[model samples]
Target: MSDAVQSVTIVEVGPRDGFQSVGPFIPTPHKIALIGRLHAAGLRRMETTSFVSPSALPQMADAAEIVAATDRLAGLDAQVLVPTARHAERAFAAGATHLSAVLSVSERHNMGNVRRTPMESVADYAQMVAMMPAGAAMRLNLATAFDCPHVGRIGADAVLALLDPLVAATADVEIALCDTTGRADPAQVRALFAAARDRFPEVRGWAFHGHDTYGLGAANVLAAWDVGIRVFDASVAGLGGCPFAPGATGNVATEDLVWMFDHMGVASGIDLDRLVDAARAVAELPGAQIGGRVRDALAARARKAAA
Candidate 1:
C-alpha cells in the first residue's frame, strides 16, 4: 500500500472480452447499449470491440459499428483489439483511435492463439506502429506473461525477453502483463511487475490484466498497485475468459475492483451503484458464464432493504 497513490484507471472490457466468450450471439444494439451504461458509470476507457475475422469471432463481426458508436462518447478512449496485422489495418480503417495488440509470451499459447511465435508477433507489431494513425494509441497485451495453460508457469526472463524487442519496436506503448490462465500468485505478480518497471523504465504506461480462476484477482491487483501500477483491464460482472486458454475463468469483475478500491480509499472515477446495475443486466444474459461476488451480494442487500 503506497499511500501516495490515490487513483486508478479501469479499462472496461465487458463489451469485447466479456461478449467474445458467450455462446449466444448478443445483438449489436444490445452490446452498444451496455457500453453506453458503462460510460455513464464513468468508465472513460473501454475495449469496445475486436477487429478479428468475422468467421473466427462472429460476436465481433460488428466491430466497425461498435467503434462508430463508442467514438461519439465524449472523453472515452474506445480501444479495439487487433490480433493480427490484417486485423490491425481493419481497425484503423474502421476509425479506431486506440488499438490493443495481444501476443502471448508463451510460445505454445502464442502459436495456438495467433499462430505466430512471440518474435514474429513483435515484427507484426512494428509494422502496426508504421501503420498507426496520428494521435492514436497502441497497447501491447503480453498474454500469459505470468502463467500459461499449456505450460505450467512462465518465468520473468521469458516475459522480459519478449519485451526487449517489443519496447524497441514501438515507443510509448502501454504494455499489459496478462494472467491468461488466472493462476498467477500475488508474489509472482509483484515480482514480474517490479522487474518489468526496472528493466523498461521508458515504458510509462503499465497495466495488469488478471482473471479470478483461483480467486487471486484483486490480491494480485493490489500487489501490482503496491508496485505503482495504475491501469487495469477488468470486465463488468467478471464476464470474460481466454477462449484459447482451457480451464481458465472470467476476468476479475470491474465492480469488484471498483468496490475494493473505493473501500481502500482509492479513486477509480466510477459510480459503483450504476456499475452494479450494468453488471446485473449483463449477468442476466442467457447462457453467459458470469462471475463475481459484489454484484450478487449488493443485489441481495438491496432486496433485504426492500423487504
Candidate 2:
C-alpha cells in the first residue's frame, strides 16, 4: 500500500446506532460519559444521536442533550443522523453541525424505514442541503445499498441511479454505502465502490458501513478499503440492528476493525486497549445485546496469563 492508502478514519456510531437498539433506556449522563471516553480514546468523529420522534425511537429522545455535551469537547466532530428534512432541521437547530442524512437504496426498505420511496428521499436530501448552515458538513448514508432483507441483493445500478441526482446537486458530500443485512460478499462490495468512484469522481469521499451477522464484516471492509474508501462506520461492542429491517444484526464492532487495521499496519489513530475498555463498559449495560470477538478474547487472554 502507498503512503496515502495506509490510514483510515473510523467514525464511531455506537452512541446512535448501538444505543438505540437497546430496550432499556440508558441515562443521558451515561451516554455523555461513554461518548467522552470514546473521544478520549482518539475517536474524533462520531454519530452521536438521531433526531426523530420519541415514540419511534425512545432512546434518541435525548438527542439534544447528547449534542450539547459533545459540543463542549474540543476537536470532536459530533454527527447526528437525520431521517427526514424536518429531522435535519431539528438537528441543525440543536447545535449539530455535522449531519448524516440516511435513506435506503432499496424501495422496500425505504418504504418500510421512513415511509417514502428512494426518489422522495432524494428530494429530502436536497432540502437538507439547502437548510444546512454555512461551514456545516453532511454525509449521505445510503443504507441497504448492498443487500436488503426485504428484496435480497441490491444491484450496483440501483445504488448509482440514486446517487446520480444527489451527487449532482452538491459538490461537497461524503457517501456511505451500507450493508444493511450483513449478507453482502466482498466481491459485491468491491464492484459497487469501484463503480461509484468511476461514475462520480467528484464525490468528496466514500465510506462503508457493514454488519457482522454472517461474519463478513471485516472481509467486506477490506474489500471497500482496497477500492480507496477511507472512512468507515463502526459500532462499539458491535451493538446495533435496524429497527425496520427484520433479522438484521449489529454493526461491525469497533474493536474488531481496529485490530484488523493495527495488524495490517493501517493507521486508525485509535487506542485499541482503551477502546476495549469502553466496549466492556457498554457490554455491561442491562438489556444491551453486544456482539464482538476481540473484547472477550482479550479478557480470556488476560485471565490465562494471570493464571
Candidate 3:
C-alpha cells in the first residue's frame, strides 16, 4: 500500500473461460488470434486455455497449440487450467508458465464440476505441484465460493473450512475466491475477503473472480480492491458463463471493469481502446456475444469519430 498503483493486472480469461462455454469447436487460428490480441493489449496475465478432456470441452481441444503459440510472448504470464496431473504435465509440456488448479468451495458444486471431493481435489493438486516444472506458477481457483445453485448461500465458516485443508496441504499457492454463479453481493465479498486476510496472513496471493449473474460483479470486484487485494479474472466483453450451473451468467466484463478503474484513475495496465477491439473480435466468434456495455459504447464512439 505504500506505493501508488500505476497499473493493475487483470487476468484475461476470455480465451479459456469464454471460448470453453460454446459447444462447437472454435478453430485453432481464431483461438490463437484471440490470445494474441489480448497479450498484445498489454494485459500481462492471461488464462490461455484449459487442458480438460476433449470429449467434455471440444472448444478447448486445441489448448496445447494455443499455449505453444502464446507462451513465448514477452512479459506474458500465460496460464492454463490443469484439473489433474495428466493435464498438468500436458500444460507444462505445452509451455504454460502459469497453471490454474480449479476447484469449488461448495461440496456439491465441486462434485458436479470435477467429480471429486474438495479435499480430494486439493490432494491431487499437491501431487501435481511436486511434479510441475521448476518456477512454474500455480493458482487455485475456488469456484462457487460465495453461493451455489445446489446449495444456496455458502457461509464464511464453510469457505474457511474448505480452504484450511488446502492451505495445510499446499505451500506457496495462490488462492482465487470465485463467485462462480455471480450470486455474491458486496457485503459478503468484503466480509469473506477480510476474514481470509485475517486468518491466512501468510497467503502470498489472494485474488478474486466474480460473475455478473446478479449484476453485482463489478461492485464486488471494487469492494475486494478496496480491501487491498489486486488480482482479478475477467472475460473480454463479458463473454463467459458456467455451462454446468443453470442460469449462471457471464464473468465480469474486461472492458467495463477497465472502464471503472480508468475513470477512478486506477491503472489496470490494460489499454481500453485496444481491449474493446479485442472484446469485439472475440464476440464475433460463432455462438459468442458481447455482454459488456463499454465495448458497444466504444464502437459507437469509433463510428462518431469517423463521421
Candidate 2 lDDT over residue span 191-281, tens digit each: 9999999999998989998988888888999999888898999999998865544555579999999999998888999999999999999
Global lDDT of model 1? 0.90
lDDT by residue for model 1 over 207-256, one digit each (tens)? 99999888899999999998989999999999986554555567999999
lDDT of 2: 0.91
Query: Where is the poorest 10-residue window by lDDT in model 2?
Result: 241-250
185 Cα displacement, candidate 2 (Å): 0.7
Where does candidate 2 stray beyond 4 Å?
A: 1-5, 242-249
Pairs of colliding residues, candidate 2: none
Could you tell me every candidate's TM-score relative to the true structure? Answer: 0.96, 0.96, 0.94
Clash pairs of candidate 1?
none
Listed per model in order, the count of residue pairs whose N, CA or C atoms clash below 3 Å is 0, 0, 1
Residue ranges of candidate 3 with Cα displaced over 4 Å? 1-6, 242-249, 302-307
lDDT of 3 at 83: 83
